[model samples]
Target: MCFRKKLWSIVLSAALVLGTAIMPANMIFAASDNESQLQAMAVKSGTLQYGDSFKWTLDSKGTLKITGKGFLYLSLDDLGDIKNDIKKVVIGSGAKEIHFSFWSFSGDASLPKLAEISIPLTTKVLSGSLRECENLSVVTGGKNVEDIQGRVFEGTKWCQSTEHVVLGKTYIAYNGTGKNVVVPEGTVAVSEAAFQSNKTIEAVTLPVSVKKIGSYAFKDCSSLKKIHGGSSVTLIDYDAFLRTPWLDSLNETTMLGKVLMKYKATAKDYTVSEKVTQIYEGAFSKCDNLESVTIKGKITEIPRRAFENCTSLKKITMPNTVTNIAYGAFDHCSALAKISLPSRLKKIETGAFIFCRSLQNVQVNGGKTNTKLQSIEDAAFAGCNNLKTLTIPWGVTTIGDYAYGYTDGGGDENSERDMVQKMMWGDEESVPKLNAANIIGISQSLGHYYAKENGIKFTATKKGSALKKPTVMINNSGELSISKVVGATGYEVYDKSPYDKHWCKAGTVKAPVRKYMTYELKGYKYKVRAYRETSTGGYQYSAFSKIKTTK
Candidate 1:
C-alpha cells in the first residue's frame, strides 16, 4: 500500500467497520499489492507513461487506445501543458480499472469516454462518466482500490458524474455530479470544487464512506434536489449546495423527520439532522420556497450569506452552539419575519441582515460583536422598504453603506431610493447604531463608498432586486406545456406531476412565467401580474396578464 493510503486506512476506520463484505472478494483479493497483481492486466496503448524518467504524455491525435495495464498512471506532472487535440482517451483491453492511480490529469478535450468502467462485484454499465464532459471524463482507482489521496482525480472525467458511482475505501476522488447519483460504499473525502457547475444532477445518495465534503463541492448544481444522506457524513464544504433547488430534501420529511437541504418535491414537512456540524456560505442560497429551517446540531458557526435571498422562508432557528456569523448571511429573506440566533453569539459580519426587510424579529443584543460592521454591499436592503426596526448586537464596529438605506415595506422603490450605498463595518467596540427609525431611501453615493470595501455587499450598479420570480402553468393545451401562473411558487405535486415527487421539497416562492401549474379558471382568463402587498401588510394583486391563457 502507498504511504498516504496507509494513513487513510487509519483515519476512516468506522467506514471499515462494515468489513469488505459490502465489496466483492475479487476486489479484496486483487488489492494484494499495486504492482505484481496489476502488471499482467496491461493491454499496450498508443500512449504510454511508465517508470521514473519513463517519459510523460503520448500524442494519440484524438483517440488514445489502451491495450493492457500494469498500473499505468498518465503522468501529467512531467508533461507541462499539452494541446487539446487528444480528445478521446480509451482505456480497455483487459486493463480492468487498476491501471489508473492518484494524480490530476487535464488536456483540451480528454477522453469523454466511460464505456469501460465497472466495480469488482460486476455491475454492467454501457456508459461510465458520460454526462456533461462537454468533452471530458475522469476515471480513477478501481472498485477494489482503497485509500487513494483525496485529490488524486480532482477535476477530470473521474470527477464529473451525473449518476451513482461506486468506490472502495481505496478509491480517492469523487468530485463530479448529475441530477440523481448514488455513491457506493467505502468512499471517503469528497474534495473541493469537485462538483462545481454540474447543473443537471437532481438527487445524490452519499455512501457511509464519506467523512468530509470540501468547499463548493456541490456549487452551482441548480437542479439538485434529493440526497440519500449517510450518518457517517461530517464536514461539509462552503456553498456546497449553492443555487441547488433540491436542497430541502436533506431536511427530514414531515412524517419522516429528515433534513431537507434543497427543496424540490412532494413532502409537507422537513427537518435537518443534528450530526451536521456546519452550514457553509450560501449553503441554501436562492432556495426561495424554504418555509422554515431548524438546525439541530452542534454547529459552532454560520458563514456568509448562509441563507441569503431565501424569499419564501418564514423562519429559522440557529443552534446555541454557534459563535461566528459572516456577512450577508441572510440579506434578502423577504418573508423571514423571525430568526432564532443564540444570545451566546460572538461576531456578526457586515450586512449580515442588510436587506432582510421582512425580518420582523431577530433577538440580537444592542452591542455584541467582535468586529465593526464592514462595508454594506449595494442594495443590501434596497427593495426592503418594509423593514421596521433595527436591533444592533453589542461589540459592533463598522456598518455598510446600505446598512439602513431603503425603508419602504411596500410599493416600487423609486430610482433615487434604489441607488446603492457602501458602509464598511467600522472598527468600533461600541455598537452605536441608528434604526430605520423612519428613514427610507438608498442613495447612489452611499452605494459607491459603502461598496468600495471588500467583503461587504457588492451589488452591481444594475437594479437586480427589482426582478421577481415568475409563475408558470402547464395546461393540457399542448403535450405537456408550461405556462406562467401569477402567484404559485412551488407545488410539491407528488403524484399529480410527471416524475416521482417523493423527493423532499423546501418550497419555490414563485412559479415561472407559463411553465407547469394547473389552472382552474373556467373561462381560461390568464392574469399574470406581480403580486404586490398593501401598506396594511396584506397582498395587493397586480394588473391582470396582458394575454389571456393560450388557446
Candidate 2:
C-alpha cells in the first residue's frame, strides 16, 4: 500500500507540468529520404499541444519527448515499411498515461517506430489503457483507475522498479521491472504472463477487487519484496515469482488463503484471502520460510502438490467448508508441526501428506459418510519419521498404499519401530470453532509417524480370534491362484467401489481394499493371481480376496 501514496501523488503532479519542450517555432514539416513526411502529433484537452505548430522529420533515431496535458493521438500509417523510426517516446507531467491512448494506423506496427513509448502519469482515469503497447516502459496510476489489461507496459524502462509501481484496477498485466504497483478496488483480474523477467521490481499490491493472476506474471524480478494480496486476489500464477530471492523476507498473511500459487523460492509466508474458494497445483510448492495459514471459508478443492515442500510451515488452520485434497498436497513439509482437516473432507489424493517428517498431530472432524469418506489415496503419509498421532475421522472408505510411513531405520532391520499409532484417537470435541472464519479451528493436536509402510495404528474391538494379543492389521486375504487373461496385461479386484482397481503384476500384488468388515490380529491371507500391464501402464489385478478379518 505504501506504493499507492507515492504513485498517485506523482500522477497528480503530472497533470500540472505537461511541457518542457515546445515546437521550435520555425520548424516545418519535411519529407524523409524514403519519401515519408513528418507531421506534428495532435495534443488534446488537458494534454499539452506541441509539434502541432509545425512538423519535424525523423531522419535519425533518438528519444522523442511528447509534452502534453491530457492525451495525444498519433496516426502512423504513412510510416511505410520502415522497420523502425521512433526509438523512444517519453511523456512528461501533469499528464496521465491514459491521455496518450492511440491506435496503430498501420498493420503490424508493433513497438518503437511506434515501439518504445513511455506515458508518465498525470490524471486519474478509470483504468490504465496501455494494451498491446509491448514497448512501453513505465505505467503508474491514480486513486481512481480500476484495472489494466495484460502486457500494457513491457520492454520499457519505467516498470523497472518493481518495488515502486502503483496500480489500481483489474485485468492488468505489467513488466516485472516497474516500481511498486497497487491494484485498487473494483478490479477483477491480473492476466497471465503480465510481468515476466523483470529485474528491478520492488513490490506489488492487490486490493480486494482482484480475483486472479496469470501464470509467471512476476517471475525473475530480483528486487521484489512484498506482495499484499490480503482477501483480495484469488488466482495466482503457479510460477509467478519463480526465482526471486527477496520473497524469503516478505510478510505473507491470511490474504493468500486459497488464492496462493507458489513455486521454488518465492512461496514464503504468502497468505491467501479469507474468502478464497480454491487452491490449485503447485500452490506454495517450495517455500521454506512459510510459518502459518488460516483457511477461512468454503475452500472446495486443494489440488495435487499444493503444499509440496513448505519446510517451515509450523501450523495450518482449515475451515469446515473444505471437501477434497489432491495428491501430494503436503509432500515434503519436514518442519510442519500441526495440521487440521475439515470435518467433511471426502477425498484425499495420492501422496497428499507424504514425507512430513516432523508432523506432531492431526485433527479430523466428523461429517463423514460411509461411502463418501471411504477412500484415502496412495502414499498419503509416506516418509513421516516423527508423526505421533492422527484422529481418523469416521466414514473412511479407503486407506491406500503406504498409509503410514517409515522411519530412518537406523540401518537395523529389527530397529524399534515408531509408536505413532498409539496417539491417533480423540480430537472430535477438542478442536474449537474459529470466529468469522466459517468454522476455522485454531488450536490443533500433534502427532508423529515413522517413515515406513506399517500402515496406520489403531485397535479393533475383539470379535473372536483363535488367539488374542495386541495386533495391528490390514487386508484379509484368502488363498487364491490365478493366470493372466489372454488380451489383458493386468487386472483389478472389484468390491464395488467407484474407483477402478489398479493393475497388478502377472505374479501378484495386494488387492486394493474399499470395505473393512473387521480388523487386527486376524490370520495372514495370501493369494496368487495373473495380470498384465494396461495402456495406462502397470500390471493388471486379480479378483477380490474372499477372506474377511475378525478380531
Best model number under lDDT = 2
Best by TM-score: 1
Instruction: Point out where model 1 deviates above 4 Å.
Output: 1-185, 195-205, 218-229, 239-260, 263-295, 301-316, 324-329, 332-340, 344-351, 358-394, 405-417, 420-551
Tens digits of per-residue lDDT for model 1, 1-551: 99898976764474378766655465454456746545544332334455312222234344444444334444333222442334544444344333233223443323333223333322111112223234344443344444233333444454446333334443233345334666666667554555567777777777777766656767777777666765566556566666666554445222111222333433323355686665545657777667787878887776777678777778677776777677777777778776656756756556576656666554543223222222233334444445554344212322333455344333334432333221222222222222333321121222222333222333332221221323444355521222343443322221112222111121223445323343343333332334332232222222223333434
Cα-based lDDT for every prediction = 0.45, 0.47
Over the stretch 315-346, how does candidate 2's per-residue lDDT look in tens digits?
A: 77766677877777887777886776776677
Residue 298 Cα positional deviation in candidate 1, in Å, after optimal superposition? 2.5
Q: Per-prediction RMSD in angstroms?
A: 22.5, 22.0
TM-score quality measure for candidate 1: 0.37
